[model samples]
Target chain A: MIEVQNISFAYKKRTPVLKDFSLSIAPGGIYGLLGRNGAGKSTLLYLIAGLLKPDDGKVLFNGVDTRLRKPSSVSDIFIVPEEFDLPSISLKKYLSLNSRFYPNFSEEDLHRHLDTFELTPDLNLGALSMGQKKKAFMCFALACNTPLLLLDEPTNGLDIPGKSRFRKFIVSSMNDERTILISTHQVRDIDRILDYIIITETNRVLFDQPVSKILSRLKFMTTDKQQLIEDALYSQPSVGGANIILPNTDDIDTELNLESLFEFALVNPQALIDAFTNNINA
Target chain B: MIDNRFRISRTFDLFRLYIIENRKFLLICAAAIVGILICVAISIASDVSYKRAYSMYRPDLDPAIPYLVPTYIIIGYIFAALGASFMFSELKSKQGRIRTLMVPANSSEKLISRMLVYVVLYTVFYVLAICIAEFFRDIYLMAKMTVAPVTPLYTIFGNEAAINFLTTDKYPILLPCILFVGVFAIQSFFVLGSTLWYKYSSVKTFALFFALFFFYTISVFMLGSSLSEGKTYNNLDHFMSNYFGYVFLCFEIIVCLFNWCMAWWRLRETDVITTKR
Candidate 1:
C-alpha cells in the first residue's frame, strides 16, 4: 500500500508539475494511472518509488516514508522507468547480480513471464532490439515479486503481439499481496487488465474508482441517435457513430470504456464527478 | 532490531555488482596505463641508445629510474583523481540514476562500495600496473644496451627516494600516513564535486578545485601579510619547524572526512529525473 500526502513537486524554474496532490493506493489490484502529457502521472510514480523527493509533504509505503529509501522498503518496491538502460551483459549475469537484492525473486516465475512474452532466459541483452530489451526488462521486473511495482509507459515500443502478451504476463503475475501501478498514455494497451482507474491532471485527480464502480455508475455505448447523444453526460465522435457515456440509472452493467471515459474526464470533469458522487438522473 | 541500513553482506553484494558492471571499462583503463608506460620505456631506451652513439652516454646510472618514479606518481594521481570524479557517473542520466538509486542498498553501502572500487581497488591496480611496466622497461633496456653498462631494474620498494618520502626520522610512519590522508582528501574533494555536477564531473571538479585553491591561497597570503605587519613573530618559525606537519596532517584528515560525508549526503538526496537539487 502507498499513500501520497499533500505532496508538491516541480522541475527547475518550470510551472509546478504537482501541487498539493494527495493519493492513496491499496494493495492487490492493477492501478491504471491515466493522464495527458505533462500531467504529473510519471512524476507521481517516481515519487512513490522514492527516486524523487517531494518538494513538500511525503509519500509513504506501508507507513514508512519512501524518501528514506531504506533497504527494507526499497527491496519491496520495483520500478521500470519509461526509458532505462540494461547493462551490456547476458540475461543470466544480469539476473544473478540484481535478483539477490529482492528477497522474493523467483527464477521459475521469471522463466514463466519470459515464456508469456515469447522470450527465452538465454538472452544477450545488448544484442536485442529495443522492444525485445523492454520485454526482457519487464519480465525480470515481474519476477522480482516485489509488493509494489511502478511501471512508467510499460507498453511503449511493443509490437501488437508483444502488447497482448504483456497484458497476459501482468495478469499471470498478479497476486493478492502485490500492487501494480502503471502510468501510461496508451490506454488501449492496458485498459482491459486494470482493476482500478485513476485519471489525473496538472494538480488534481479528476476521477478515481474501481472499474466495476465506473461501469455501474456510467454506461458506455456507440450510437448514431442524436437523442442518446443529447441525454449522455459525455459524447465524442467515433468511426461509425458517436461514443457516449450515459448515467446508468437502470443499473445497466456496461463495460468500462477507458478511452471514452478518459476523454469524458478531460472534457467534462465536473459531470463525471457528479455522476459518481450525486447519482445523475436518467 | 538489527540495523539494515549498513549491512556488510549487502555492501559486499553491491561491491561485486559494481565490479561486474564496470569490468570492461576497468580493463580498458588498465590496458591504457600499461600501454602508455611501455611507450615511455621505449622512448627512454631510444634516448639512451642515441646518447651512446653520440658518445655522450652516462654508463653508471640508469636514466629511466629517475623519470619512472615521477611518471608513475603523476600518472597514478591523474588516473586516481579522474576515477574518483567519475565514481558517480551512473547518476548522470535518468536511466542510470534510476538503476543505481533503485538498488536495494542503503546510501552508505552504495557510497562505500563505489569508494572501494574507485579509490581502494584503483590504487591496487595502479601499483600492479606500474610493477608490470617496470618489468617490461627493464627488459627493453637490457636488450637495447647490450654492449653498454646496464644498471639493475629499479625496485620501487627499495628505492632511497621512495623510502625517504615514505619514512622520516622523528615521525617514522607519520609521513606515509599523512601522504595517504592527503591523497584521500584530494580524491574526496573530486568525489564530492562529482555528486554536485553529474555531467562532465571531472572537468567541473578540476576547474572548481583550482578556483577554490587560488582563492584560498590569496586569502592566506593577505591574512598572513596583515597579521605579521610590524610584528616580530619569533615563535612562528619554531612552530612551523616543529609542529606544522602534525597540524597539516590533522587538517587533511578532517578535510577528507568532511568531503566524504558531504558526498554521501548529496548521493542520498539524488533524484533520478532532476539535474538540480
Candidate 2:
C-alpha cells in the first residue's frame, strides 16, 4: 500500500505540477490513472516511485518514506518510466546482474511473461527493436514481483498486437499481493484491464472509483434518440449515434466506456462527483 | 542490529553490474592506452636510430628510460581524472537517471560500486597496461638497435621517484601515505563535481578547481606574510620542517573524506526529474 500525504512538487522555475495532491492506493487490483497531456500523471507516478522528492509533505510506502529510498522500501517497488534504456546485454546476463536485488524475483514468472509477449530469454537487448525492448523490459519488471509497480505510459510505443499482449501480460501477472498503478493517456489500450479508474487533472483528482461502482452508478449507451441526448449527463457524437452517460435509474448494467467516462469527468466534474456521492447516500 | 543500508552483498552486486555495463568502454580504454604507449615507444626508437645513423651512437645510451615514469604518471593522472569525472555520466539524461536511481541499491552501495570500478580497478588496469606496453616497447627497441642495450625494459614499479621516496625519505611510509591520500582527494573532487553538474562535468570541475586553487593560494600567501611579519622565529622553521608532512597528510585525508561524503550526499538526493532544491 502507498499513501501520498499533502504532497506538492514543482520543477525548477515553473508552476507546481502537483499542488497539495494526495492519493492512497491499496494493495491488489490494477489502477488506471487517466489524465491528459501535462496533467501530472507521470509526475505523480515518479513521486510515488521515489524518483522525485516532493517539495512538501511526503509519500509513504507501508509507513516508510519513499524519498529515503531505503533498500527495504525500494526493493518492494518497481517503476517502468515512459522512456528508459535497457543495457546492451543479453537478457540472461541482464537478469543475472539485476535480479539479485529483488528478493522475490522469479525466473519462472519471467519466462511466462516473456512467453506472453512472444519474446525469448536469449534476447540480445541491443539487437531488439524499440517495441521489443519495451516488451522485454516489461517482462522483467513483472517478474521482479515487487508489491508496488508504477508504470508510466506502459503502452506508448507498442504496436497493436504488442499492446494486446501487454494487457494479457498485466492480467497474468496480477495477484492479490501486488498493486500496479498504470499512468497512461492511451485509455482504450488499458481501460478493459483496469479494476479501478482514477481520472486526475493539474491539482486535483476528478474521480476515483472501482469499475463495478462506476457501472452501478452510470449507464453508457449509444443512441440516436434526441430525448436521451437532452437528458444525458454527458454526451459525445459518434458515427451512427451519440455516446451518452446517464444516471442508472433503470438498474441495468452496461459495459463501462472509459473514453466517455473520462471525457464526462473532465467536462462536467461536479456531475460525476454528485452521481457517485448520491449513490453512496442512497 | 545489523545496518541494512550498507550491505556488502548488495554493494558487490552493484559493482558487478557496473563492470558488466561498462565492459566495452573499459576494453576500449585499455586498447587506447596501449596504443598510445606503443606510439610513444616507436617515436623514441626512431629517434635513437636517427642518432646512430647521423651522429654518435653509444651502446650505453637508452633514450626510453627518462620518458617512462613521467609518461606513466601524466597519462595515469589524466585518465584517472577523466574517469572519475565520468563516474555518474548516466545521470546526464532523464532516462538514464531514472534507470540508475530505480535500481534497488542504496546510495552507499551505488557510490562505493562506482568508486571500485573507476578508481581501484582502473588503477590496476592502468598499471597492467603500462607493463604490457613496456614489454612491447622493449621488443621493438631490441629489433631496431644494432647493439642490444644493457637494460632492455624499464620497470614501471621500479621507477626512480618511487624508489627514492621509499628508501631515502625520512618518513618513507608517511610520504607514500600522503601521496596516496592526495591522489584520492583529487579523484574525489572530480567525482563530487560529476554529481554536482551532470553535463560537461570534467571541464566544469577543472575550471572550478583552478579558480578555488587560485583564491586559496592568494589567501594563504597574504595570511602567511602577515603572520610571519613581526616574527623571525627559528622555532617556527624547525616545527614546519619537522611536522609539515603530517599536516599535509591530515589535510589530504580530510579533503578526501569530505569530497566523498559530499558526492554520496549529492547522489542520494538525485532525482530522475531535475528540479529546484
Candidate 3:
C-alpha cells in the first residue's frame, strides 16, 4: 500500500504545486491518475517514487517512508518517465546493469516482453527509434516485476498497433500483488484498463474512487431533451445529443464514458463528492 | 523494510551497473592513456638518443631521469583530474538526472559506489599508467645503453634521485603517497564542484579553486612578512619549510573532506528540477 499524508511540495521559490494533498493506493489493479496540465500529477508521482521530497508531511510505501529511498522501498518500485534516454549500449547490457537491482527480475519475462514488442536484446538501445526505445524500456520495467509500477505518459510515442500491444502486455503482465499507476492526459489510451481513477485539480484531489463504484453511482447518458440536460449534474453536447452525468437514482449500471466523466468531475466535483458522501452515510 | 545504511553486496551491484553503463567511456579513457604513454615514450627515447650522441663532445647533457618520474607523475595527475571531473557529469543531463536518481539504491550507496570508481579506481589506473610509462622509458634507456655508456637504467628509472631527495622521511613511499593524496585532495574538490554545478563544472571549479589558492598564498605571505619584521630571506624560508608546508597539507585534507561531505549533502537535496533555488 502507498499512503500519502498531507504532503505539500513546491519547486524552490515557486508557488506550491501540491498543498496538503493526501491519497492512498492499495495493492492490485491498474490506476489511472488524471489531472489538468500543471495540476501536480507528475509532481505527486515523483513524490510517491521518492524522486522529490515533500516540503511537509510524508509518503509511505508499505509503512516505509519513501523519502528515505531505502533499498527495500526502491527495489519494489519502478518508474518509467515520459521522456528518457538510454545509454549507447546493447539492450542486453542495459538490462544487465539495471535488472540486478530488482531482486525479482525475470530474464524469461524480459525476453517475452521484448518478443511481444518485436524487439531483440541484441539491438543497440541508442539506435532504436523513440517509440522502439520506449517499448524496450517498458519491456525492461515489466520484467523487473516490482510491486508498484509508475508509468508517466507511457503511450506518448507508441503507434496505434504499439498502443494496442502495450495494453495487451500490461494486462498480461499484471498480477494480483502489483499496483500500476499510469498518469497520462491521453485518457482514451487507458480508459478501459483502469480499474480505479484519481482526478486532481488546483493542488487537491477532486475525485478518488473505483470505476465499478463510480459506474454504479453515476448515470452516464446521452440526451437531446433540454430539460434533462439542464437538470443533469454535468452535461456536454455531442453530435446527435448531449452527454450528461446524473445521480444513479435507479441504481442502473451505466457504461462509463471516461472523457465525459472527466469533464463532469471537473465541472461538478462538489456534486459528485456529495453524492458519494451521502451514499456512504446512508 | 528498507535498509537505509550501506550494504556491501548492494554497493557492488551498484558499482557493476555503473561499470556497465560507463564501459564505453572507460575504454576510451584507457585508449587515451595508452596513446599518451606511447607518445611520451617516443619523445623520451628520441631525446635520450639525441643526448647520447651529443654528450661525448658537449659533455654538459642533463640527465632526464631525475625529472622524468616527477613529469610522469604530473601527467598522471592531469589524467586523474580529467577522469574525476566527469564523476557526476550525468547529473547535468535531463534524462540522466532522472535515471540516476531513480536507480534502486539509497543515495549513500550511489555516492560511495561512484566515489570508489571515480577516486579509488581512477587512482589505481593512474598508478598503473605511470608504471607502464616507466617501463617504456626503461626499455628505451636500455636500448640506448646497448650502444653507448649512459646513466644506469636502475638508478634513474627506479626513482633513485627523487627517493634520495626525500630520504628525510625515511620511507621513500611516503613522499609519493603524500603527493598522491595532495593531488587527489585537489581533484576531489573538482568532483564536488561537478556534482554541484551543472554547466562547465570543471572549469568553474578550476577558477574558484585557483582564486582561493592565490588568496591563501597571498595571505600567508603577508602574514609571514608582518611576523618576520626584519628577518632575512633564509629565516623566512626555514619557517615556511618547517611549518607552512605541514599546515598547507592539513588544510588540503580538511578542504577535501569538507567538500566531499558537502557534495554528498548536495546530492541528497538534488532533484529533477536543478534550477530550484
Candidate 4:
C-alpha cells in the first residue's frame, strides 16, 4: 500500500539522512520497523505519512504522489508521531475536533478505545497524566480509522498494563482494509503484534520478513558455557554465559528474539544476508 | 463528486476545534474587557466623564468621539490573542495538531475558519461592552435631567439605526479582524524562526526579530529596502498614501500569505520528529 523508491532526504545542510532508501509495505498486516539511534526510521515514516516531502526520488501511496498532500492522499494516512502535543481541551472536544477530519472516525469506537485506556472523555486532556495523554492519542488515532496508520515510538510512555493494552488494541482496533507500520528502538514492546519485521540501516532496508518465516530460518539462544554454534553470525556475552543467534539449517523449533536479530543484523550484516540469500522469498 | 463529500467544509470544523482549543483563553480575554468597561461605566455614572484617552481610561467614553477608541482597543486585543493562540497552538501541538493539517482539507479553509470564529466572537463581546458603556451614559444623563432635562435615547446612541449599523458593521469587525490578522501573520514569522532553532524558539523569536530588523535597517541605510523602507510610514495614512486602504490592506494580505507559505515549507523541510533522534 506504501512505496518508497530510492528516496533521499536531509535536514538543511546536514548529511543525507535517507540515502536512496527503498521499501514496499503492503496492506492488512502489522509491520515492526527497527533501526539504530540514527537509522532514519522516523524520517522514512514521516515521508510516507506525507508530513515531509522527500528531497530526491519519490514516496507514493497507492501510486499517488505523497508530496502533493492532497486530501485524497493524506486523508487515508495518519501518523502518531513520537511526541504529540495535546490541546487544553476536554476529551469530548478533542474527539469532536478530529472526528470531522476522517469520515471513518466512529464516536462509539472512540468511547470504547478511551474506555480501554481508562481515559474519561469528559475530562480535559491537559488534566490527564503523560501516560494517560499518550493513551488518549492512541485511542484517537485508532478512531481515525485511516487505511494506513504510522506510529513512531508509540510504546514509550506506557507502563506494563498500558503496553499490554496497546498490543491488544492494535490487533483488534484496526480493520483488514488498513496497513499499520510502527517504528521504534523499543522493539520488544510491539514484538508480539508485529506480523512482519523490517530492519533499517545505512538509509535502506536491511531485512524484511514475516516473524513466522524469520523464526524458521534462524535460532536465538543464551548460553552460559560460552558455547557457540558453527554457523553463528554474531554473539554477545550474557550474565551467566552468552547470547547467540545462528542460521537455522534445519527446521528446529526456536523462539524469535527481535532485539538479538537487530543486534546480529547490525554487527554481521553480510553474514545475516548470506545466510538468508537462498531463502529470500520465504 | 467525491470531492463534495471531502469538501473544504473543514473550516467550520476547525473553528470548533479552535474555540475548544482556546476556550479558557477566550474566557480570560472576555472577562478582562468586560471588567474594565464596567468599571469605566460606573465612574461615568458618578459624574466623572471625559477622561483623556491616554491619561486615564474610564469605564466608557463620550459616545461622541469620532472613532470608538476603547472598542477598537479591546477588539484589537481579542484578535491579537486569537491569532497568537492559533499559530502557537499549531506549533505547540505539532505532532498532535499538525496531523490535522494533513487531512484532505484546504489550507485556506483551515485558516479562514479560525479567523471567522475570531471575527464573530470578538464582535459579539465588543458590541455588548459598548452597549453597557452607553447604558452608563444614559444613567448619568438621567440624573442631570433634574436641572438639564435631557432624553436618554438621543444622547446614548446619537441615532439608533446608525448605532445599530456601527454595532453590526462589516467594517468595524472586518478592519480590526484584518489588523489582528496582520499582527498574527507577522508574529508567526517569529515562530517559524524559533522552530528552526532548538529549545529557545521563544527567546530566539525576539533575538531573531531584532537581529533581522537591525540587519535590514542597517542594510537600508547602507544598501537599500527589504526590511527598512523609511521613517515616512507610521500609521495607515502614511502606509496607504492616496490609494484606497483596501489596496494597502491587500498588500498586507500578501505579506501574511508569504508568512504562511514559509511556515508550511519550514515545517515540511525539518520533518521535526526526526530531530528526536
Candidate 5:
C-alpha cells in the first residue's frame, strides 16, 4: 500500500543517514522497523507520511506523490509519534476535533476501545499521565481506521500492563486494507506481533525478511560448550551460554530469536542473506 | 483497497476545537466583557451624565466625545489571550504531535483551523464586546436623559452618526470587520513564532501582547502615512472604502491560507517521539 523509491536523506552535510534506502509494504502486513539510535527509521516513516520533504526520490501512495500534494495524497494516513501531547480539553471534545478530520473514524469502535483503555469521555487530556495519553491517542488512531498507520516508538512509556495491552490493540486494530509500521529500539516489547522485520544500518537495509522465512533459513541456540562450530554463520553469548545462528538443516525444530537474528544481520549480513536466499529456492 | 476518504477540509474542525478548548475561557471572556460594559455604563451614567457621553463640554475647548479606548483594550485583551494561549498548543509540547500529525486532516488543515479561531472567532467576540458596550451605554444614556429635553440619542454611537458612519458615507460595516480580521491574521503569527521558540512560550500570554500593537500600529501607520502626500506607505483609506474593505477581506483569506500551509510544513515532519518538552 506504500512505496518508497530510492530515497536518501541527511540532517547535516556529509553525514548521511539514509543512503539509497527504499522499502515497499503491501496491504495488511504489520511491519516492525528495527534500528539502533539515530538510524533514520523515523525519518523514513515521516517521508512516507509526506511530513518530511525527501531530499531525493519519492514516496508514492497509490501512484500519487506524497511530498508535492501531501494533504491530498495522505489525508487518510496517520502517524503516532513516541512523544505526543493532547489538547487540554476533555477526551470527548478531543475526539470530535480529530474524528472530523478523518472521514473514516468509527465512533462505535472508538467507544469500545476507549472502554478498553478505561478512558472516559469527560477527562481533560492535559491532566492525564503519559501512558494514559499514549493509550488515548492509540485508541483514536485505531478509531480513525485509516488505510496507513505509522507508529513511532509507540511503547516507550507504557507500563508492563500497558505494553501487553498495546500488543493486543495493535493486533486487533488491523484489517486487510491497512498497513501498520512500528519503529522502535525496544525490540523485545513488540516481537510477537512483528510478522515482518526490517533492519537498517550503514545506510542500507541489511535484512528484510519474514519471521517464518528467517526461522526456516537459520537456527537459534544457547549451548554451554564454546566449541568452534565453524558451520555456524555467527554466534554471540548471553549470561548462561553461547547463542548461535547457523544454517537450518534436516528436520530440526528450533524457535527464532529475533534479537539474535537482528544482531547476526548487522554483523554477518552476507551469510544471513545467503541463508535466506538458499532457503527461498529450497 | 479501501476508498479514498481523507479530505483536507477536515482541518476546519480546529475551529470548533479551538472554541471548545476555550469554551470556559470564552464564557469567561464574555463575562469579562459584560462586567466591563456594565461598569462603564454605570460610571458614565452616575459620574459623567448624558451631557458628557454625546457632548462632553470642556468649557475652554470644544466638546470631545469620549471614545472608550479602555473598553477596546479590555475586549482586545480577552481575544488576545485566546489567541496567545493556544497559538503553540499543538507544536510546543508532546500534544502537538498527537493532535497535529495523527488526525486525518494533515498539517495544513490543523494550521488553518487555528488561524480561523484567532482571526474569525476572537475578532467576532471583540466586535460583540463593543456592540454590547454601546447597546447598554445607549440604554443608560437614554434612562439618564428621561427628565431632560435634549436626548443624546440624536448624536449617540448607534444613532444618526452610527448609521451614517457607513451607510451615508463610503465605509461599509464590512470595512471594519475586514480590517479587524486581516490585522488579527497577521497578529496570529506572533503566536506561531512563540510556538517555534520555547522560552517565549511561558511568557504572560494575553497580558503579554505584541498582537494588539501589531494590529493598531499597522492601521494607524498606514492611515497616517496615506494622509501625508509624500509618505511611501499609502493609506488604504485612499482606495474607496468598499474597495479597501475588499482588499482586507482578500488579505485575510490569503493569510488564512498561508497560515495553514506554513503550519503543515512545520508539523508534517515533526518527530512526535522527540517533540516532548
Candidate 6:
C-alpha cells in the first residue's frame, strides 16, 4: 500500500507538475495511471519509489516515508522505467549480485518468467535488444516479489506478441499481497489488465475510480441517432456511427473501452467525477 | 521495525557488486600499466651498445628507479581520478541513475562501498601492477647484462644511493607520508566532484581544480610576499622544515576529511533529475 499526501513537486525553474496532489493506493490489484505528456506520471512513480524527493509533503509506502529510502522499504519496492541500461554482464551474474538484496527474490520464479518470455539465464543482458532487455528486466522485477511494483511505459518497446506475453506474465504473477502500478499513454496495451484507473492532468488528479464504478455510472456505446449523439457526454466518430459515453441509465453491463474512457475523462472530467462519486455515495 | 541502512552485511553486498561489476575495467587498467611499462623497458633495452655502455658507467645509478617513483605517483593519482569517475558512471544517464538509486541499499552503504572500490581497491591493484611490472623489468635487465651486471633490485629498493636519498632526514618517510595524505585529499576532491557533475565529470572537475589552483597559487604568492618578515631564504627554509611541515600535514588531513564529507553529502542529496541535469 502507498499514500501520496498533498505532495507538490517541480523541476528546477519549471512550473510545478504536481500541486497539492494526494492519492492512496491499497494493496493488491493493477492500477493504470493515465496522463498525457508532462502530466507528471513518471515523476509521481519516481516519488513513490523514493528516487525523487517531493518539493512539499511526502510519499509513504506502507506507512514508511519513501524519501528516507530505508532499505526495508526500498527492497520491497521495484520500479521498471521506460528506459534502463543493464550492466554488461550475463543475466546469471546480474541475478547473483543483485537478487540477494531482496530477501524474497525467487530464482525459480525468475526462471519461470524468463521461460514465458523465451529467455534464459545464460543470456548476456547487455547484448539483448531493447525489447528483449525489457522482458528480462520485467521478469527479474516480478521475480523480486516486492510488494510494490511501479512500471513506466512498460509496453513501449514490446512488440505485439511481447505485449501479449507481458499481459499474460503479469496476470500469472499477480497475487493477493502485491500492488502493481503501471503508468503509460498507451492505454490499449494495459487497459484490459487494469482494475483501477487514475487519470492525471498537469497539476491535479482528474479521475480515480475502479473499472466497476466507472462502468456502473457511464455507458460506452456507439450510436448513429442524432438525439443520442447530441445528448452524449463525449463522442468520437467511428465507422458506422459515433462511439460515445453517456449515463448508464439502463444499468446494463458492458465492456470497458479504455481509449474512449481516457478521451471522455480528459474532455468531460467533472461529469465523469460527479457520475462516479454520486453513484458510489448513493 | 526493519532497518538495514548501516548494516555490515549489506555493505558487503554492495562491495561485492562493485567488485564483480568492475572486474573487467580493473583488469584493463592493469593491462594498460603493464603494457606501458613493457614498452618503456623495451625502449631502454633495444640498443645493445647503449645497454652495455649504460650498465658499465653507473653501478650507483639504476635508471628504472628514478623513472618508477614519479610514474608511481602520477599513475596512482591518474587511476584514482579514473576510479572516481567510474564509481559514479551510473549518474550519467536517466536509466542508469534510476537503477543505481533503486539498488535497495541506503545512500551511506552505496557511498562507502564505492569508496572502497575506487580508493582502497584501486590503490591495491595499482601497487600490484607496479610490482609485477618491476619484476619483469628486473628480469629483463639481468638477462641483458653484457658488460657490468645491472643490479636486479626492485625499483622500490633502487640502488643504495637512491635509497639513502629517499630515506634521508631532509626528505624522510614523513614527507612521503604527508604526500600520501595529500594524494588522498586530491582523490577526495575528485570523488566529491564526480557526485556533483554527471556528464564529463572528470574533465569538468579537472578544469575546476586547475582554475582554483591558479587562483590559490596567486593568493598564496601575494600573501607570502606580504607576510614575510624580511627573513633570509635559509631561515625560511629551516622554519618550513621545523614547523611548516606539521602545519601542511594538518592542512592535508583537513582537506581529506572535508572533501570526503562533502562527497557523502552530495551523494546523499543526489536525486534522479538533479544528476541527469
Tens-place lDDT per residue, model 2, B152-221, is: 3445244443354233345546655655676677788899999999999999999998797688657655
Q: Which ten residues in a row have the lowest lDDT in candidate 3 chain A?
A: A273-282
What is candidate 3's lDDT per residue for B188-223, written digit by digit as tens? 878888788878888888898889889987887776
Deviation from native of the Cα of residue B29 in model 6, angstroms: 2.0
Model 1 chain A: worst 10 consecutive residues (lDDT sum)? A273-282
Mind giving the per-residue lDDT tens digits that candidate 2 earns over A70-181? 8888889999988889889999999999998888999999999999988889999989988899899999999999999989899989999999989999999999999999
The residue pairs found clashing in candidate 6 are none
lDDT of every predicted structure (CA atoms): 0.83, 0.83, 0.80, 0.67, 0.66, 0.80
Off by over 4 Å in 3: A12-14, A223-228, A279-282, B1-3, B44-62, B134-159, B165-174, B220-243
> Which candidate model has the greater lDDT, 5 or 6?
6
> Candidate 3 — what's its lDDT?
0.80
Q: What is the lDDT of residue B260 in candidate 3?
A: 80
CAPRI quality of model 3: medium
TM-score of chain B of 1: 0.80
Q: What DockQ does every candidate get?
A: 0.54, 0.53, 0.58, 0.30, 0.26, 0.56
Per residue, candidate 5 scores C-alpha lDDT tens digits across B90-207 of: 5555446445554445455556666676656666766676667656765765665633222232244544443333332555566556645645564555555445543445354333
- Higher-ranked by lDDT: 3 or 6: 6
**Model 3 share of native interface contacts:** 0.68
Backbone collision count in every prediction?
0, 0, 0, 5, 8, 0
Q: Compute the interface RMSD for each candidate structure.
A: 2.6, 3.0, 2.1, 4.2, 5.7, 2.6
Ranking by lDDT: 1, 2, 6, 3, 4, 5
Identify the runs in model 2 with alpha carbons over 4 angstroms from their true place. A12-14, A280-282, B1-3, B41-66, B146-162, B165-176, B219-242, B275-277
Model 4 alpha-carbon miss at residue A200, Å: 1.5
lDDT of 1: 0.83
Rate residue B269 of model 4 by lDDT.
Answer: 47
lDDT of 4 at B207: 70
State which candidate, 5 or 6, has the greater DockQ.
6
Question: What order do candidates take by DockQ, descending?
Answer: 3, 6, 1, 2, 4, 5
